[model samples]
Target: MNTALDPTGATAAYLAKLPKGAVETAAHYTQGSHWVLVIGKLAAVVACLIILRSGILPRIAAMTGSRNRQNFAVFATGFAALLLQALLLMPWTFYADLVRERSYGLSNLTTGAWLTQSFITAVAGALVGGLLFIPLYVIIRRAKQRWWMWSSALLALLIALATVFAPYAAGLFNRYEPLQPGVVHDVVTDLARQASLSGEEIVIYDGSKQTDRYTASVTGVGGTARIALSDTVMRDPVDIPAIRAVVAHEIGHYKHHHLLILAGAVALLSCIGLIMAAFAFPTALRLLGGGGVGGISDASGIPVLLAISAVFTLVTTPVVNTVMRLVERDADAYGLNLAREPDGAARALLATTSYRAPSPSRLEEVIFYDHPSIESRLRVAMEWKAAAQGR
Candidate 1:
């Protein structure tokens, strides 16, 4: 079964089709984001520090002055702290999300659209914070020493809810319609059948209104599950193979229960983080708490807890990313086997270079990438093709 086909050579020839300098330009944009990630974390810490030292939240909480108002106070102070952090990070957010994306020709948003989206996101985040943190504070007050365990359970529930309801939630922002009858639709339906997924779950969303990049995902569980493709991906009839390849990859995620796995992993990490934070809370309270902060249950202590959580997440990023990348690699292999369209998979992976760096050094990928580099994925696809042809 030995084949003379050189997968590496084939992959190189495929990549050589890219416009000169495309890879370098995309790489520069992505590499710069590593700095942005570091700066953003620092800014969040500084923002929390300001809130801790300012005594603003404690003053607001004190204004509640009634046992009945404690829950409301939690929401109010947590919402305020979140808003303040967002405000502090706004400059960096604007630069990184909009200006930088526009410079790289990746963003399709106008300033007005960006502002509208940002405002909507901010409002939604504040609402969710109010809903989440109020109950969180209640847990802290009642559970006391065991709050970390209870809080982790609550976090796990929220993660499950978020994952299951993601498609419906996304519809609030983007218009989704069932894909029309066509070659792409036919291919997607066939793939869905092979994967034993509901054909009714295939949808197309108007993502071109936001970005020109191709995107697709399978999300939710039970009745809420959907396989959604961005309109950009299906705009051209010739893109059928790429669309098939992407959808197959998404189907692989569903078959492997990657969403559930990721959700569980995040919840587990959060529990670990809370455990660590519980141990570290007292030291942080002493060093950063000042006169405004009282203790873990106090409104002012929220920022300190937040700062601790952010630090923990930053520290665990590489490990988290490595796990995610491995999952993605597994899915890629599954997709190749299921779809038997390695060339199409290779093409789809290459198309992602419109925004993603086609290749990053091993160290760069290890630290920053949650998906395998395109070069690696393409090589694997090529190898799959050669093996299939030989067989």
Candidate 2:
């Protein structure tokens, strides 16, 4: 796409329909349907928790014979809740995040394209995370004694698996591309792999699919190297400096080990959840009804797990995002050095992220925004450029 001002006149206007207010407003109340879909997942985390805490089965168990039965009641209830949550949220998340992007000018996908992408994402998440849950549940049941250690160890395995899963799925869906040489290819390569980011094609998607915005990224780790730019980017009259600056910032993510760091954080999180679930979940066997190692006892321990997991989520999300912001700062700084130009980057920042208050409250950025606001990045870019030029 031509981010250069369209000399073709009307081409610029037609492509420039992304309204700042609309985007800003939509950014407010917020949404998504596919739940754990489109890579902006919530299915495994949110919905699973809800179903357990719903108390449907808990009420049933509480009224039954085993008033002290925590294990069976919680386990059964939690498993059912998690499954139900996935069934309900995955479709919604798929629609809201991916579909809406295409629908509201944020995505440039045809209905078929959108469906294909959403379906792929859903299948991948379910196959990797959803399917694993069932066996994980069963395993906890069988190894009730050493649940935490086994669970933690299992968590580590799952985390390792989860990290590799996306890259494989990306290839399965024909999403992988060898990074080709471009103006910034060498720089991206240097950033991704210190000694061997070579032959890696910078896989970028047409991000302009749903909105007239300029955004780019280095997503995934190791072999799953992907870089995406919205269609809004090419059509817009953004100066090259900002484009390069942004690209460089994305490269910074690779260069500064952001992927490795993010992967580590995620691994820790999943490990904790798994280990906790392993120990915490097994305890429920003593709650409702259980057959010990064999038969059916009372089957009502699932809800307890749900309630615990839900409480953990609200606390963990904020922490994860904070870590994300810290890493983003590092990438932004790196981008400044690589781009070697700040003015164009600043201008591009303005045009692309007009919806984002150049200066958001600290809390807003922490809780709501993922990437640093354009102002924040541009600020660092200009500051660095100014110092380099002795201005």
Candidate 3:
């Protein structure tokens, strides 16, 4: 990994000194956390299946008393399984999200606050999963052999719906307000105008309430679309040009409709994964002594389905991450042209190295990063500057 410090710029200099070992430590922590969560959740699913095979889930279903209670059983089973996974993974979550972030000086969240947030996240996930379980179970029972096809369609619809409501959903966790009149606000609005985005879409959010990360994003779809900057960006010693470059990058995402494309790609992947799961689930279940579980509809089959889906996702990670990296690189190019501040763009890229490695191996970048490495991004910025100067 290229860890060379930029020799000429204040922003780059500050970024260079941002707590050594953070990049490698963060990468190890992140990769370890991902595998730990995956293994822990898979184990929990197996444990839940064992409990189901022991007739606990059936007993729980019996309590609903025969008013077409299969739907109730499915929801209850899925929720219980999810809760088990959460419980099993809670220690990892705390260590990865709260402890590691604090150790790296990235997070400002107190333990209580972090716990509250975790609880909210867990409850929210359970609620959404339970609600979706009803329809999913219906499709499984009704479609029989074709359940995966319908489920894939349902997944796509859900992705679309989530995209539409994501901005509102995000507001539940963080506070947002308009960018107050200032140079940052002026630069942001100017970029919005240049990108044909509405000034109303530009806002500032209290991101520093949770993390010290300086960042921005273009989120939501249609009327919900928003350009938001973290309070860290507003207050951090980053120059106006760097801030503008960041905003321009976000605008590039919006201008290029990257969100729509991303959602579509994810939806397509969901379909492919579900199609694979359709073929894999029954065989896996039969081998696991779960043939007694009635087709895909049986609440007991949830673990097998989950396991298959997880494997499918794991296998496809490289393809999906590659697509995301390409999209991000396109946005970088657009931002460079729009902002006309390659140096600022390079500085902004460096600023994020507190957590992200300034350089990563090509294979590592392809497999793990959804965005281009800082080295790649800075190189693009420098090349753009060189070309522009030659002109």
Candidate 4:
């Protein structure tokens, strides 16, 4: 191959603009977060063990003192345990989400902003958790031997609902505005048209309020479908070709319905995890001395259930990440082919190094990453360009 057409050389030249120090800093932050996440999962498991051993949940369940209020007891006990877990994890959350992000020059949020977002997110999560927990225990008690199957189905439904409503849920944290008439906007509209998407589905949002990273996605379904670009992309030093490539990538997601497909995949994974947790629940209860807990249906069993779920989640992280990474890489290929802007795609991927590491070892990427390394994605684009040039 000619030097001008060498994919590896071309990709390197495109990425050469990124300072080595910047890539190193991003890699340090990202890799450090991987360990933080692992440690957090371990800590959560330990907390659950402590809670179960303390018999605090049983004590909470006993507060109602009446079998008629079993539902209420379940809600109260579950909520209290969740609250305790949150309190236990607050310090770690603060460091990983706020302190560390700011240190890396990634977060654009002030302390007050962080606090506000955290409070809103926590409250919303608690409400959703309460709603789900009461019924989950109800399913356990009523369904008995078949609880796992029915409960998993319910969880799948909830996941689908969440996927459909995500666009609205996101509005609670950031303001979304329409893209103005401009080159970027026009390019996005053209790409959407090419991908058979409605122009009304594209919007820009104030994502810079939270992070300095360049981010975009196609969210929601049907009537709520939105191709959202962060205002970070609209700021000065706008790279038009890169924007076009990124938008095309998101358009590819929409065209292929990747979000719904991913939601289904996640729902299936959740079902598998729940089934495994159900099988382990009795054994776990026995190991924990079955203190003050009647069975899996008992409200006091919530801590043990949560612990089992955490363990399963930790074990399954790589599987979930692999599925997500494959979809992302496929979307990149689809976008490059559609947009015919391989250099732009390469540049756009390089821009992700603001927060993500540009490169990682194969094992690290397989185990920890939810997207292809920037290096690999750039190479894909360069290879596509070389093939196109040869043709």
Which wins on TM-score, candidate 2 or candidate 3? Answer: 3
Q: Name every residue pair that clashes in candidate 4.
A: none
Question: How displaced is residue 54 in candidate 3, in Å?
Answer: 6.2
Residue range 19-121, candidate 2, lDDT tens digits: 6675564444232221222233334444544544455655644654574544444444444445465566657655665565555555555667666766665
Question: Which stretches in model 4 have alpha-carbon errors above 4 Å?
Answer: 1-4, 286-290
lDDT of 1 at 324: 89
Model 2 clash tally, residue pairs: 49
lDDT of 2 at 84: 61
Residue range 151-265, candidate 3, lDDT tens digits: 8889998997786567667687799888778788788877877776653466788889899777898865544458888888866464898888888888788778787778788
For each candidate, the alpha-carbon lDDT, in order, equals 0.83, 0.55, 0.75, 0.82
Ranking by TM-score: 1, 4, 3, 2
Predicted model with the maximum TM-score: 1
User: Model 2: how far is 187 from its true place, Å?
Assistant: 8.3
Select the stronger candidate by TM-score from 2 and 4: 4
In the range 36-114, model 1's lDDT, one tens digit per residue, is 8888887788888888888888888878789788988898888888878777778888998999889988888899988
* Better-scoring candidate (lDDT), 1 or 3: 1
- Model 4 residue-pair collision total: 0
In lDDT terms, which candidate is top? 1
Model 3: runs farther than 4 Å from truth? 1-55, 236-238, 286-292
Give the Å shift of residue 320 in candidate 3.
Answer: 1.5
